[model samples]
Target chain A: MAMSSALQNGLIQLQLFEEYSWVFNLLFYVIFVVFIFYGQRIQMYVMLREVEGSLFKLKYIKDEGRKIAIETIKEIGKPQTDPAVRVDRFLEYFTIGPQSLDPAGVVWKLEHILDIRDVRFKDEVKLMAPATDDTQAHNLENTLEAAMALNFIYKIIRHFYLLGKKTLSLYIIMQIQMILPLIMREAEAYASALKAFAYGQPIGDGAGALVAAKLMRGHEIRKVPKDCVVATVPIEGRTTFVMKAEGPGGNVGKIGDAIKTVIDENEGKIATIIMIDAAMKLEGEEVGEVAEGVGAAIGGPGVDQFKIEESILKHHIPINAVIVREDIGDAVSPMRKEIFESADKAIERIKQLMLERTKEGDKVIIAGVGNSIGIGQ
Target chain B: MSKTQSNATTRISSFVLLIIFLTLALSLTALILATTFFGQGNEIIAGYLLLIGFIGVALSTYVLFQTRRRMLRLRIEIPPIVTTIECRKCGFKSVREFQRGDYIFKEGEPCQKCNEKMLITAIYREVKDKEKTA
Candidate 1:
């Protein structure tokens, strides 16, 4: 009778284990579904934030420039002719003037009176004017429609992201509610594993490092000592780099001079300069997604991109850019595996490129170009 | 600036004072009814009503004071004449005078002359000389 009781007890224990396993599997499936649904939505929010920030900045700049333009116009005073007559004469020029005289040039001349520079974008403005005798008749309904469509898409994506985040939070709460006791029992093991992952020595042949090296093909990679001045430039936007080499001057004109100095000083030691930056993503593109592109100069107002491009060209240096495409909505999330993978791939590619470019005594520059928010130099 | 206008202002203030007394009387009547229906004690309900009444009086008084002060400080001045250049390509033109928060040109408005969209080129307040006494 005692032997039969022992067998019954074993059977009950096995049944309990099976029941627990079934519950665990159910929870796992629910969490997986929540992650998939909300992940896309979170990405959309980040993109929106990015676009909004850029638009705000652009508007600020334009407003300031507009103020300056108005002041200049006021100082110059109106033409001697009657206001209506002057306007009439200006309109007459459009009909009778040299056909070769482009709309941009005409607008530029007008803006020149106001001492407004960079009137090249006047054509875009002109394209949106009304068809009244006093205004340009260009119908911009199509463009406005396109803009509205883009806004709608962004809103939909953001809605999804918020939904996903909420679902994830709920799932976590549910898990805690159901498995609080179990979690408490295994807390010690969980803590130790986390600690080991954080500070433990490289494991399993340094797979991460090997993956990074493979991605950085065609570039030379040399682990330089910390505090070494790899590359530096007085660029307009805030840039965070692993090793920033500070040079003289703040304006765009001095960019070439600074780059040349840095390159010359570290010639044999430094390999290629890898510039990682935030790039505006086209509509429908994923935020925080990384793309490898040939580095192009993107200087702000008064800082011409051509001048910087010319400088790099003059030095015959290959500038590779790993751009993080994001939108206006603080759309950057650390949890996105794709972003991390892309970043890793970029780093690996840069490493390989550096190794290929540099010889025995070369140095490499990896410049993380963006607003240094939540990212260390 | 004129004696006649100052007298007119005093008359308006007196009229407003009369209106406030009537509003207070009406509100007190309403509070009494509310207390009766809600089964609240006279002192407790009256205290609550008094608080609300005081706030209302304070807000109205502040608004009235501001309006009166502004009327007293009002200075009639001649408007400045301005010349503007309307863009032929886009109806975007330089307007001489615009009040704060006014849109000189809205987005996506087409130009009349060149069939281009109008973009605000300039916005400014016109400066004019005060009329001289003969």
Candidate 2:
């Protein structure tokens, strides 16, 4: 009997121990989940604060015109079905209309879109008084407050989700270390090409082709003169800048316009109008690689690539383009090695083309199409 | 350039770190439970740990495999287009065509009349033309 009792006790002890372990595990998992949630919440809060600060700083800048632009953009904001579509619509509105603001205008517009006005206590009280009784009014107010709170929570959660996604995307980008050297090399080549053109050194098939096309199209050309006025326009994109120069001589609107005017004034001397712009590459494209092609011109806001293209076509000029395809990031940033190498190759091509088209004395025009930000144009 | 690549590298490393963390957490919990329940000869508990480890490794391996496969499939679907030019100096014309980088021209060079130095200018689709012809 004693033996059987002891056996029962042993079995009960084992069962209790097993149950205890299970409970402990459950508690551990719960704690772990709580830790992760809290950590993420804190991270989200920090990001929100940073974004809010940037927005506030933008608002404080003394620009009434920008403020008005912002207000207008905010009023026009509607829920978009697709993110890309929304961005495109925003860009259209931001760029096309007479109301279109520059980058400063864009900053103000974003600010007004995100602005939140505080609810007045007196107004709330007045609204509550419309209720049948004090109790009812109080209840209505409470409900409204609850709804507002819920809405606020929803917005916060949405923002947190966006932040998390951005963070994850950045993390993924961090892992691909193999592509950087190529981007740098390309950026440098691009910068050097611009510099060379700015100094009036005849380089590349693109330069020559541009000259030939310009001359063919009836743009006036000049042989390398002792002192020629050269204008540089840098075409900027989402990533990189393509700097090109117009053949020397002629003062017009901006550098781009100056080049166009020069071509117009010296008609019949220019052979071709080659517009060098940054091109996006397919996946697995080598960094800083040059892809020569005849394609549509691409540029940023305020730099009218299309206008240039139209002008060229209007004059019946045969247009050729020498595009250096760099990864998106390298295109925007300036002075990498690849940009220099590509520029060198492009210049070499232009030189070869020039030798083929005209004698040593023939003048050519090359326009660097991009934003003149880092390299002082 | 360094900064951009570093960002990508850090992201991949973080993923690996996350997997390691989850595995460690799982193993630690199992160990704690095993110590509590299987007091003396815990060989069976050790076996459970081994099983969990195997499962974790398998899951991670599967994730890596899926990611690599997706990348490869994307590459095959959108291979880079290389431009080829048949410069017929005799004809005084250059015939430009889009070709795959691996494709070989009929004349073993880019010239139209006789084999001569040819430059690849642009790449576009030949498949659409072929489809139309068919």
Kindly state the number of residue pairs that clash in model 1. 67
Superposed model 2: Cα runs more than 4 Å off: A1-256, A295-298, A301-303, A357-363, B1-134
Provide the lDDT at B10 for model 2: 19
TM-scores across all candidates?
0.26, 0.36
Give the per-residue lDDT digits (tens) of candidate 2, residues A1-377: 99997678677767867877888799999989987878656555555544443222222211221222222223222222222332222223211223444554553353233221112422442332332232222222222332233233334434544554467443333222234345333433333232222222222322222222222222233322111224322212111111233222110113345445655666735555555655666667754465555544444333344445656676665555667665543442222344444655765554554455444444455554442221211
Taking the candidates in order, what DockQ does each have? 0.01, 0.02
Instruction: Candidate 1: list runs displaced more than 4 Å.
Output: A1-258, A267-271, A297-299, A302-304, A330-342, A356-360, B1-134
TM-score of 1: 0.26
Task: Evaluate model 1 with DockQ and give the value.
Answer: 0.01
lDDT of each prediction vs. the true structure? 0.37, 0.39
The fnat score for candidate 1 comes to 0.00
Number of the top-ranking candidate, with TM-score as the measure: 2
- Chain A only: list TM-scores of all candidates: 0.31, 0.40
